[model samples]
Target: MPNPIKVVLVEDSAVAREIMQRLLDSSPEVDVVGTAQDGIQGLDVIAQTKPDVICVDLQMPRMDGLEFTQKVMSDYPRPILVVSNAVHPSDVDNIFNLMSAGALDFFPKPTSGTATDYEKLKSALVTKIKVLASKAK
Candidate 1:
């Protein structure tokens, strides 16, 4: 088998972070190499892990996802996937801004707690990660 896709997760919410971690853990194609609760720490984690892809939340403390994406694009330049709650209009702007800043793709975080929703999210997440990793290769 090939090496799993290494990923660094940056999200401020502990519950959201845990949820993403669990979802990624269940995917055999992805690997959670590191996780950070804020963008400041996320930078350090990214540098240390040198992951193949990054999963980030937009609204975070210390530094937001847009800032993080700009910094990473300028420095690391890896595949960044925004896994955020894009509920508000401002969040839509943030998502677009993050893309312009060099995020490859994004998935709006699921609002519902249904298992089917979670499964779809998981499938999309894994598929995106694989595609991004393939492009990187």
Candidate 2:
């Protein structure tokens, strides 16, 4: 069988972290190797796990998502998916900036506080991670 897609989630919110973990756990093809509460911890997890994908929150403490993304791109060149609560149309420009900076995609934070919020985008997210991970390899 093919290797499962290993991922690391970097989210500061306790509720969001649990929900994301549960969502990833439900998918047999995607394996969440580790999780971090902030960008600093996320960096440590990434160094240890070298996961195929890194899902990061935008407004984290210690090191915000943009800074974290910049560091990862410069130092590791890994596939990154940004998760944030900024979903307004104006935020599209900012999201595009992140994409230009190295993030492969952005997903709006789920309002339900559950992984079920990811149901609509899970397939797409997985596909994008796979594609970007291949490029990183």
Per lDDT, the best of the predicted structures is 1
**Residues 1-137, model 1: lDDT tens digits:** 88899999999988888888888999888999999998999999999999999999888889999899999999898999888876244666776787789998887765447898789888888999899888787
Per-residue error for 38 in candidate 2, Å, reads: 0.8
| lDDT values, one for every candidate | 0.87, 0.82
- What overall lDDT, based on C-alpha atoms, would model 2 receive against the true structure? 0.82
Q: At residue 13, what lDDT does model 1 achieve? A: 86
Could you tell me every candidate's TM-score relative to the true structure? 0.90, 0.85
**Model 1 CA deviation exceeding 4 Å by range:** 87-92
Error of 2 at 53 (Å): 0.7
Candidate 2 lDDT over residue span 27-84, tens digit each: 7788999999998999999999999999999888899888899999887778898878
